[model samples]
Target: MSFTLHKKEKLKSKKLIEQLFAEGKSVSNYPVKLIYLKTVHDDGSKIKTGVTASKRNFKSAVNRNRIKRLMRECYRLNKPLIFNNIVGDYAFMFLYLGKDMPTYEHLEATFKLLFKKLIIKENHEKLN
Candidate 1:
């Protein structure tokens, strides 16, 4: 798969987002949390992902947007971890859980760790 995150790969449907929150499971690595659900999409994409920064933590929209941008970039770079190993389509929401602003390096590390944990969790679930 390509490193680029195309428009179709983005999680945009309001209905899907609600269902994800209601039925999804989560894997968290410190300031980053991945909320995911196994579901098929009509678009045929293997993963549909979204990133969010809490407004309660970051009051300014600028800071929130910056954090989200960093999260998206980190996920875009590290997403192959999920795509290559997982067998089915899933929806993911990456949530920023810390109160402080994070640097790219920190977020990147967190993203890698979080995805690794997610893979392990998924595999373990499959075995049961």
Candidate 2:
């Protein structure tokens, strides 16, 4: 799979976003938390993802935007972990949960751990 995160791969539906928070399960590694929901999409994409940084924590649009950019970049690079390992289409939201600014290295490491945890959790669920 390509390493680019295409427009269709972005999660933009208001209804879907609401439902995701309502029914989605989450995996977290410190400053990063991934919330995911299994669902079909009309676009036939394997996954649709969104990233956010809390305004309360960030306090500035620039900081929040920077955090969000780093989150998306990390997800874009590491998404194959989910696409190759998981079997179904999913909607995902990555939330920044820390009170301080984050470095790219920190986010990348957290993302890898978070995705691994998600994979393990999904595999365990399937086995049950």
Candidate 3:
């Protein structure tokens, strides 16, 4: 599968977003927190994702945009790692939580770790 994230895979449901924050399970790795919920779809395909930079942490819009860009890039590159471990549909929101700006290298490494954690997380959820 291609590493490109399509428009269809971008999470944009306001209702789902609210539900996500209310009912999702979260796992964090320092500068990033991933909150995800398994969603049922007729096709049982596709993982929709969103990214956010808290206004509380990054006051400037530029800073927030930059952090979101980095988050998306890292997520796009490593998503295949997650796709291998997941089945059906899931909606994910990646929240940036760092006090200061983080480098692309640091974000990339952390994203990799997050992917691994997500796989383990899903496996555990399946067992419970």
lDDT of 1 at 41: 87
Q: How does model 3 score by TM-score?
A: 0.94
User: What are the runs in model 3 whose C-alpha is more than 4 Å off?
Assistant: 42-45
lDDT of 3: 0.90
lDDT against the true structure, per candidate, is 0.94, 0.93, 0.90
lDDT of 2 at 42: 96
List per-candidate RMSD values in Å: 0.6, 0.6, 1.4
- Across residues 24-63, which tens digit of lDDT does each residue of candidate 1 receive? 9999999998999999989889999999999899999999
Question: How high is the lDDT of residue 122 in model 2?
Answer: 98
**Candidate 2: misplaced stretches above 4 Å?**
none
Q: Is candidate 1 or candidate 3 better by lDDT?
A: 1
Model 3, span 1-128: residue lDDT tens: 78998888888889989999999999899989999998964444578899999999889999999999999999998898988878778999999999999999999999999888888988987899
- Worst 10-residue lDDT window for candidate 2 reads 75-84
